[model samples]
Target: MTVKEVKKGNACALLPLIIFVALFIGAGVLTKDFSNMPLNVAVIIASAVALLMNRKEKFEIKVSIFTKGAGHPNIMLMAIIFILAGAFATVAKGMGAVDSTVNLGLSLLPANLLMVGLFAIGCFISISMGTSMGTVVALAPIGIGIASQTDIPVALTMATVIGGAMFGDNLSMISDTTIAAVRTQHTKMKDKFKVNFFIVLPGAILTAIILGVITRGNKAVIGADFHYELIKILPYIAVLAAALAGVHVLIVLIGGTIFAGGVGLADGSYSFGSFLKTIGEGLMSMEDLAIIALLIGGLVEVIRHNGGIDYLLYTVNSKIKSKKGAEFGIAGLVSAAAIATANNTISIVVTGPLAKSIADEYEIDPRKSASLLDTFAGSWQGILPYGGQMLAAAGLAAISPVSIIPYSFYPILMGGCAILAILNGYPKLGTKSKEVKQVATVPVEE
Candidate 1:
């Protein structure tokens, strides 16, 4: 493509996203209430801007591109998951599963360590599920209930779930972000995991410590009337176990829904008609989140097609000089892409080639490059209020996404550690292996 045709660093191409931030975040700041402007309305306005900016393309073509993005396999899958998660959550709650599970947890763990325990649970579930969204879907309701029963703010509790979810997203071997990072940088998954584990371990520990300290004074008061039922809690246990066994997340949620429904039926919690109605109610509850995801998908696709992402890459690529610079560039590149796409795996896949090139030029370790890419992408995903992780958690908890940002301690710490790694060359950068160097120019499969 010709230089003019490439449209690198074209500011106008990013206007839609800029407008979105201005409308969503700026409006919140001005109004002093983040929820004053609904997320869907802001997205819709920005999408219209994107469509208007692409005047050169036929209206039909533009609509087709937006539709393609909205209907992307990943986006569609997330939409389906949202519906299933809503059903599972509603049915499980109707069956008294959430309360029973919460009471069981309260009975087992010390009151003061509740937040820490929740964080740990989120970490385990996300690592097992290999998807932060899945982890959030599974645990957010319980987190909500725990927060309501304790002195903890609901936002802080949800943030804990987000922080832990991102921890696994960055480190899990089966995570899409991990797979993309490893393959793009020509590193083995195990090597990348080893490097990633050490780099982020300190952050995780600090987060846990912070959570404990903050929550130490806020002990939960378990009510004498609260009782646990093992049968009611089986759905959650079964879902966690199935996820750990490498079952597909969709199947896990569907199975959980069915299991919870059966429990409700046997217990006479709801008749068959009522059970079906509850499922419908749950699906309807997820309507807002599903619409927002679709809008974001379409909006992001337009930005990408209009050269916004290319411009971001061009700007970041122009500044790299030394190995450390390249490392930071890779981190920044993926972070920016994640901000634009609202999906870490997609960001990694989009920027992996550029990151590989930067690594090769600087002779940086593939493991390090892979780790940086995954770490930064995951970190950004955790912070973006409109991103799926936070959105899913917020939707499930019936809270605003912006409220959860400040308490996302683990993700913030992870980002800090990533910056430190780039500056200090953590894990000790070594000479790039010949095999890695040879494959540096190869295209990676997404």
Candidate 2:
């Protein structure tokens, strides 16, 4: 059977996405419990709706499209990473790594500076891992434990971690968002980083200061005799060391898992069978996220095929004229994609080509466009209650994702700074006046 092609700028093709938001957000609002409706369930429903919207095509052909999207290289890679992260986190926790790390941190940091310290840790871990979700998986539990021990609110503490996680997500050279942005705009990674760093540095410093001042009175209650086994923390150290040395995330996680199991065995923390059980359970824990990601992937592919994404691109393109407007348009594109997809890296990938076109048309520097894409995508990703970063943090902390939104100071500040950068052309090195036409004309490598 011949399949009917969707026309570009077909707004009706976006109904499935609207249906998804309505069902997901509406359920949460109606139930007054955002976690009551499982995200996978919502995504499944949305996927079905997306499938139904493709009625003009043969059923088997539609299924193929959905399957292809679900099995996209990027989606599969992310699924593997989620599985590895879960196993690593659970194995490390079983081996007492998290508690030991928390104890060591508490012993070193003053009580009043707990929030700032945790934020810094989150930043460091995310920068090393080059993934916000991995950083959240490693740090959220510790942040929760810290909150339980101190007067700091769990939401506030987790928010600090989420904020810091986003900080590194925006700036890390190895981050998927960074790679997508740089490749899409045809800019060197270092050039993008230089522009991104100066734009975000003020926000990071301001966030740290804000966290410190707010938690100044909440001193941690650490006992003088608390014992932390250094060996138990080796897994995390190894992971960080490998990640900082530019190892792939999957390798880092695999090595970390084995190291944690070895440490557990040597310390007699559990039997070999128990170690296997923990790893299995950890992988199982990520089932919901993995499933939801796949469903979202498939659904987005359907939407793209139906011209939803093209509609978005068309809408943004029609409104761009001046340099500031072009910057705002790029930011708007990525931000909208982030909100729609609930994944920053995917958002960058989806919006990158369109953004590059806008930059070329408006004489905006490729590096600045790359920075806008990464920064705005991260900014939106951090605050979205259903976004992976917030979901992971909330899941680990056993709190509502909504609860963390109010305290996501760093993401909020980063977004504000991004807007200011667009408005005032902050970095100043890549403005239209100094535009390198050759950079904008550079071919984007697929």
Candidate 3:
């Protein structure tokens, strides 16, 4: 057995992750700008720290350990999906799909339902785009516009946008977080989405009602202010529909890209040259995430090899007895990862493997674990002051991120709903894991 495969875990194995998080959040806190600390750089430093530990092993063995984790099939597939999803998204947006979809959602909104409408729109756009940041960036200005026209506070309006963005982020078929959660837990993306969507639906509805009450008597004059081409919105709808129908993700993305590019060409939205260029730009946009995944995988492998994961699991497992306790442990794990990273996608990637192991150990359904991973991470990332989603929304609205916290009804309610789901054991995907009994037989046949 290796150092990591021991009956007793080594507590010291966790130092690398601790140091990385410290550097990341510490630098962000000091600079008051989380973006100042590049995740790639911090992870690289942490990885080096991990390599320096347990130096008695041959250097080749140490390098092999990192490579083993970095080259994991799940991690490799996730990077490919990220790259493909980015390309599809870029093509769709290049064809005016995002703008048209936004315009269409807003144009249909009843003037009195502005706040709830924005929330719903945020959800739709984020779901289609598979990115909360993209949704926030696209809708923050619109939220501000609506706020200026109505009695709603910009903070509340912006919070609504953040809520909607996160809702979709937690459940979007193509979201990297969802992909990571599903891939790591070995569950189908559609299965995870279905479970995650229902789990958070109540919270979303309640949030809408709350926004409705808060925005009562307030009118948003968005009439005739935006124009949309219905045809331009087809690609998003097509991709979403196909994915939910359980089509292969790669097919959905590639087909969506081709369809969107054809539309863009026909509409003169972009030339053939521009279409190729947009694909390149999209791929580039995802490079950081892809690279980060590889580095994190390698870093985490080193940690795991040193028994950090085993120790953490041992600690969590000690207090968890029943299935409910296991679920709670998973929730706690997801939430802590989110709190540390302040990015839902990164948090999911950071905790995915560990969550899977916990699920297997407890025989908890992988789907439930996946849902918790996405939902909890989404819930926490939105309300955090230093999170990119909140920071981006605040920056666009020219308001304090702190002000947005009071009105972040969706994510707060989301966390509550997730807890309730655990308490009730919703979905009841009865434990599918069982211990294998090795049957021994003498060589009687010989």
Maximum-lDDT candidate: 3
Give the distance in Å from residue 192's predicted Cα in candidate 3 to where it truly belongs. Answer: 1.0
Q: Which residue segments of model 2 deviate by more than 4 Å?
A: 1-7, 111-115, 121-199, 213-224, 322-327, 333-408, 421-446
lDDT minimum window of 10 residues, candidate 1: 437-446
Error of 1 at 277 (Å): 1.8
The sequence of per-residue lDDT tens digits that candidate 2 reaches over residues 12-112 is 87787777667656776789645566656777887888888757798788788889877766556556666777787778878887667655665676767
lDDT of 3 at 375: 90
- lDDT per residue for candidate 3 within 99-171, as digits (tens), equals 9989988988998888888999999999988999989989999999887877788999899999999998888
Model 1 ranges with Cα > 4 A deviation: 1-9, 111-202, 210-226, 321-411, 417-446
Model 1, residue 188: displacement in angstroms? 14
Which model, 2 or 3, shows the larger TM-score? 3
Put down candidate 1 lDDT per residue, 1-446, tens digits, no spaces: 32123346576888987787677567757885556777678889999999888688998898889998787655565566666667776788788876676456546666678888888877765664456876687678778888888778999989998998899888764465775676567666557777898899999999999999988887565454547898987887787566546465567778888999999999999899999999999788778767776777788778878877668656765676567887888887788767756768767765676677667767788888899999999998899887888888988888899999999999999999989887777877466533332222333222
lDDT of each: 0.76, 0.76, 0.86
RMSD of 1: 7.2
lDDT of 1 at 170: 89
- Cα miss at 336, model 1 (Å)? 6.5
